[model samples]
Target: MHDYTIRAFVQGNAEFVGFDKYAEVFGSTTFPTALLNTAVFTLVSILFQYAAGLALAVFFRSGFRLSGVLRAMFLVPWLLPLIVSASTWAWMLSSENGIVNSVLGAFGVPQINWLTSPDTALLSVIVANIWLGIPFNLVILYSGLQNIPGELAEAASLDGAGAWKQFWSITFPLLRPVSAITLLLGLIYTLKVVDVIWVMTTGGPGNSTTTLAIWSYREAFGTGQPDFSPAAAVGNVLILIALVFGFLHLQLQHRQEGS
Candidate 1:
């Protein structure tokens, strides 16, 4: 990979001479677009997963009938292997006989080409990722909710606090730690989400769904010609983003402890 990049640099086809490959990749338009797409994908997945998971956690915490069964059912997707999950989603989103299009047809809607369309391809992968993520958040948050002191809620109620008030004052506060952990872990997982996109789209439709990870993989392995330098550059960018989140989370925890 490095040898090819060096050769490319030596060929003078790329700018900056010896580091031509790096310059071309870094200076290319595709790099920025890939970064933006990935950022949006990660942000959207985390937002929806955390929100949906928190809601489910709250609902299941009430000990409603069949809550245990429901919780297990929600976790089924998470228990599946990632490749299996991606493949299943790919089948489900296929344009012709896919369940998604079938349902749309039943409702008198046009069949949508999820994987083939650049507009919806990234979103299709994001939806699959959200499915993979929500269960984890639910399990963690539900367990955290279970660990909170019942006495605190009871005390709040005794002080004439309503259910909503008690929850805001007691339940949500106690779940802060759990929420933090969930968000941090979710960010890490979403940052590295490649399989779902790979299996479903292969960064297709004019590279609309190309993420940094996918782009890096293609550069290193695609075209039967490896270029490790650009791939390494992409890897470093992803690591840097993850590291930023990790560092921020740690600082927040330390400050909370000190306070």
Candidate 2:
């Protein structure tokens, strides 16, 4: 990145000159748009995924008939290959004849241009990612709940506290450490996600879905002027963000262990 394509140009691979990659990256009209899309996509997806995962964790933590089978079933989305998930979602979100639009039409709602419209393309990918991430969050949070002393919940119930109160007053508080780790890992993973977005929209509909990872990828791999320097610069920026969050996760884990 520091050399700014000088070596690549020397090797007759690139045509760009000067250390203008960074400037070009930041100055581009799509840069801020991509940043905004990334922030909104990651935050909204993680928020919904954590909530759904925690709810699923609580639901199946207790003994119930067929619970084991059903819990395993819920993980199918997470266990599927990234390419499979991406392709499946792409078809489901297709603007022409997707199942999603059909369902919406059946409910008297207008069919959505899910993957075609810039306004909804980012949202479409975010929904797919949330579905992909929930099972992972479920397993982690469920394990944390299992490790919590059951006596505390029993004691709260004995004190006449209802289920909701017991969860808020006892269970949820004790699940804090695990929740922090889940969210940190979610943020890091979501920041670098490329396959889903690439397959679904290719960061398209006029760059409405372009994110840091997608931007880096297109710069390095997309045809017509492949430049490694700018891609490296963008990728380095993405890695820096992930590393900061990873460092925080380690610190949080250390403090939890120390206490």
**Candidate maximizing lDDT:** 2
TM-score of every model? Answer: 0.87, 0.94
What is the C-alpha local distance difference test score of each model?
A: 0.86, 0.89
Give the per-residue lDDT digits (tens) of candidate 1, residues 132-246.
Answer: 9999999999998988888888888999999999888889987887788789889988888887888888888888999998998887776676776778778777888989999
Query: C-alpha displacement of 8 in model 1, angstroms?
Result: 12
Give model 1's TM-score versus the native structure: 0.87
| Deviating ranges (above 4 Å) for candidate 1 | 1-21, 253-259
TM-score of 2: 0.94
How close to the true structure is residue 113 of candidate 1, measured as C-alpha lDDT?
90
> What would you estimate as the lDDT of candidate 2?
0.89
Give the best candidate by TM-score: 2
